[model samples]
Target chain A: MKITIQVMVPPYSYEDLDTAIKIAEAALDKGHEVTIFLFSDSVLAVNKLVKPVKADRNIPEKLSQLIKEKGLRVEICGICMDYRGVNTDMIIEGSNPSGLPELAELIYTSDRFINLMA
Target chain B: MEKKVLFVAYQSPVGSVWPNEVFRTAFGMYGEDIEPAVLFLDEACVTVSKNTKPELLGLFPLTTCHRLIKRYGTPVYVVKEDLERYNVKEMEEIFNPQILSRVELSDFLHQFDLVIFM
Candidate 1:
């Protein structure tokens, strides 16, 4: 099945990012094609400046790597990123900036759509 | 064209006005053309509680989203795990809402053309 996920919660804390990552990994491991669209505060998940201060996981880096290795489509909401003052240079490598039009298109085309909000 | 839109509200309806605003927007935009299905999970389940009295908050005290949307023939389901976790089983006794499990929720995702999480 093709699964499209909209992550609308910011990954300010470890628990939040962990949950999002786990869900994405689980969906992929279950033999489903996955696309993650980051919106609202969730755009922070791909912010390059927000480093994992103490945790060993480094979720943003992990997400970036996963995007490259798994060929996962990672789209951050363009409007949301602008509202949050997130620069394109600050976005983690491999993730693309997108808007609601793409989000609507993904939802229309996917077999399943999941929203992980914080 | 008629489409299936699954709306997921994951926030509390009291402290924040987002739940109502988003729903109102969606209803206005797609109410006539789409079959809207709502799922209340996590803190969002409180919005459907029979005991909730939104009147005291001085806002438009519209607590029963199920009833409001159902009037328009939309189907609303509340997550059973969330209700159990919040000790809101009494809500079911009062409102008789459809109880949905995780698997059932996953299946519901497959049936929708679009899923919006607020």
Candidate 2:
């Protein structure tokens, strides 16, 4: 199954991001294709400049690593990023800019769509 | 074949963005291969009351959503358990929303190809 998740909250603000990652990892482990669509504050999770202490878990870095190692596809909302002043240079290297059309396409194509928000 | 896609709204619509965002996404799927619907479950049934006004909470009026739901023929649903909790047995008949029990809802959910919820 192809699973697409739409995340609307920022990382670390709540358990949404972490839980999304766990679900994606579990799905991937089961040989399912997973893609995450970051919108609203969730676009912040793709920022490469998110630095945390050596002891703390860096959520954005974890997402970036997943994109590299686990083939997790992350697409940040273009308008949401623009509104938040998030440029391509600031986001995870593998993440791409997308729009509502892409989100609709993701919804239409995916076997499962998970929306993580308040 | 039309793909059944459900957007589950679990928050009260007064000032929260989840219900608005969920409905907006479901409505945005105009002229698509997807059949998008919005379900008001959990605390979201607070917005299902006939007299509730989102504008009173400084949010946009839901009349616009009602208009879109009518025009696009999008399905809107509120949970029976939640309605009982809020003592709101009489909801606006704008779309004549389907009221399903928790168990019936679980069974109905299986009919969808995708279910989006936080």
Best-performing candidate as measured by DockQ: 2
TM-score per candidate, in order? 0.58, 0.80
lDDT (Cα, 0-100) at B9 in candidate 2: 85
The sequence of per-residue lDDT tens digits that candidate 2 reaches over residues A1-118 is 9999878888877788898999998888898999999988889988889877888889888888888989899988898899899999898789999877788888778877887764
Q: Residues B1-118, candidate 1: write the lDDT tens digits.
A: 5668777777787776556644553454341445666777788787668776667878656545445565554556788889888777456333345888877877878897766777
- CAPRI level of candidate 1: incorrect
Q: Flag regions of model 1 displaced more than 4 Å.
A: A14-16, B8-17, B20-117
- Residue pairs clashing in model 2 are none
Off by over 4 Å in 2: A22-33, A68-71, A82-89, A111-118
The deviation in Å at residue B5 for candidate 1 is: 0.8
- In Å, residue B37's CA in model 1 sits off its true spot by 7.3
Candidate 2, after superposition: displacement of residue A41 in Å?
A: 2.8
CAPRI accuracy category, model 2: acceptable
Instruction: State model 1's lDDT.
Output: 0.71
In Å, residue B114's CA in model 2 sits off its true spot by: 2.0
